[model samples]
Target: MIPARLAAAALAAAALAVLPAAAARAEVEVDPTRYAALGDSYSSGTGTGDYFDETCLRSNRAYPQLLANGLGAELAFAACSGATTSDLLSKQLGSLDAETDLVTVTIGGNDIGWAEAVTACITPLTDCMDEIEASETLVEEHLPGLLDGAYGAITNRAPNAAVYVLGYPRLFNGERTCGALKQPNVAEQVRMNQAADRLAEVLQGKAEEHGFTYVDVRDAFAGHAICDDVAYLNGLTYPPAESYHPNEMGHLNGYYPALSRAIA
Candidate 1:
């Protein structure tokens, strides 16, 4: 038999010894193998300097890859670049199942003809505002129902998964730094950012309606937009098609941190 004080001390030591193992078990309970990534260009890492596939442009630097690596989650599926909500319903939903525990999506930009709006802004004689407003009308009228259907399909497919609907960042830094022919003016850039904000709001509302999380990247990319001194978004690339997409730093610094925090 030991002294009462000594016995109490020994019990305390035993409890301390059990804590680390219990914590480790808790960590393992997360099931890292069940993650699936789905979305459009930003999620696919379009302008991130490297590609896993030419057509998909899936970059190893994308936020999904980063989160998967950090959490030791198996990235079982990833579809991005050029994918719209309709595309997601037709093609990407096949990747999710009841086993899927984690998912991230960034879409709807393509659905509203975001690329066309950008082209209109850069084209010599096109009315950029008119084009943008037309796109906004689509967002207001058509996009909600489309998003709801997409979200329903996703949740139906991956019944147990935690779905995160990520939104795009503003592409401009409220400045007119690029060539007049290559980029929109400061006023137009502001309007573009506002449109992006409106889209994000719509996405957030849809996500809430479907029991999913909405991750906003606008603030993260504020100082790193196309016209910034150290821009994270590509500004009128040689091919010109790469303009306004997030580069490597944008995905890593701008996207990854925000996603990590949200999942945490």
Candidate 2:
């Protein structure tokens, strides 16, 4: 309806108004660069690679590292095997500093101390439960204090980081195993997983109490639990090597997605 010259002038002005807004949107991108990880064997990729450390303490393929690889984030994947909540508060496993960007942690299974209890008493269910009961007593007695200390450490050091407390994945599925050893009795196995879940809950609450984010990985591995995947998880019946550790599939496929998003 308007003349061609008039219409063109109006269109040009509108276009100029929107161009600055578009440029602002493009400039408002998130640069997720810094990342750090802390935790136990579940996060450490204990048995996946041939890194060959004196102890099965750390692995190159740990979920945190996998996340780093997938996202191309600079990493400080300090996850270690046999880590406990207390270790988070100490310098035994690794170090923590002030400039960390993102922090992820997985632990508390060893607090239940199921390895020694189950390994030493695999033959007797009653004795295993008794040992677990005793360990539970010890853990319960000191668990809260240890968690408090850990939260204090992370908050004290990386006050600005987005710290995530990752939950442990279920280690066994029903009556499965690695070999000769029948694995921890099914009931005990359930108890152990439940204990780990409880520990995660405690850690999550504690982290929140200290201003950190907590990511629950238990529900994420629902169907893919050791019982469901015959090939993926290390079942006790197969053998006793990594009876309680995550299988390779568990480390790479199961946890990577759940954890990477948080870290990334």
Candidate 3:
């Protein structure tokens, strides 16, 4: 009887151990009451074109709104159209606090004059490579410290939040240059994509260092670049602010899904 009882106790202990391991493999469900979307144009939905607040270009079609609505969480949308890392620290961080339990940010492009570089690429006689090379140098030299300051501020403000630092998508398909006038050629497009890749690499490292999840959307937007049949990003649009930004479908299909997969 003693031997039989001992075997039964050992079996029960093993079952308990197995249950925990099984639970660990299950999906992570983040149900936060206070969610803050803080960053630049990507989070603001600049290219989507249905802006409720023109100053910030906040759109209903943006990924933040979509994600917030999906999770049934109250959102403090603080992203603006032309925000840099410095802009994020000064203007956007106001939305986050200790009570905030979820935060998502996509920044750092504007810091290195990404838009200006694209403009130079599209201008008739300007040397695009020189401008792109300058931006790349800033990415290597200066953007890290700027990101560190912004990220540190976020962690400090939202101590309990599950923060996600989202990276930018590669804007070009790289096979064909399809836009109208003075568009980046195939070779230029390839280099631009390489710059995007470098930015993602930097963003991923900084995010991980700060104990936040880094969501890379390059893979998500792979076949959906500007020249693709079903392009997620805008290619030199009319209101130049919208140029090179993700359209509504991009937020829906690319950014939102990448973020969803990260937390889900």
RMSD list, candidates in order: 8.1, 9.9, 9.0
Error of 2 at 218 (Å): 1.4
Best by lDDT: 3
Candidate 3 clashes between residue pairs 3 or more apart in a chain or in different chains: none
Q: Deviation in angstroms for 93 in model 3? A: 1.4
Instruction: Give residue 124's error in model 2 in angstroms.
Output: 5.7
Off by over 4 Å in 2: 1-32, 52-56, 92-95, 124-126, 175-178, 236-241, 261-264
Better of 1 and 2 by TM-score: 1
Instruction: Tell me the lDDT of candidate 1.
Output: 0.81
* lDDT agreement with native, every candidate: 0.81, 0.64, 0.86
Candidate 3 Cα misplacement greater than 4 A, ranges: 1-32
Which lDDT value does model 3 have at 141? 96
Instruction: Tell me the lDDT of model 3 at 156.
Output: 95
**Predicted candidate 1 versus true structure: per-residue lDDT over 1-264, tens digit per residue:** 122322344565566667887663543222334678898888888888568877888888888888888866778656768898988998898889887778889889999978888887767655689878888999999999999999999889988788888889998987665855745777778888888888999999999989898889888888888878888898778545457799899999999998877866
Q: Candidate 3's residue-wise lDDT over 170-245, tens digit each?
A: 9998898776774788778888888989989999999999989999999999899998999999999889889999
Write one digit per residue (lDDT tens) for candidate 2, span 73-119. Answer: 67776666777777656643245555556677776667766577667
lDDT agreement of model 3 with the native: 0.86
Error of 2 at 42 (Å): 2.0
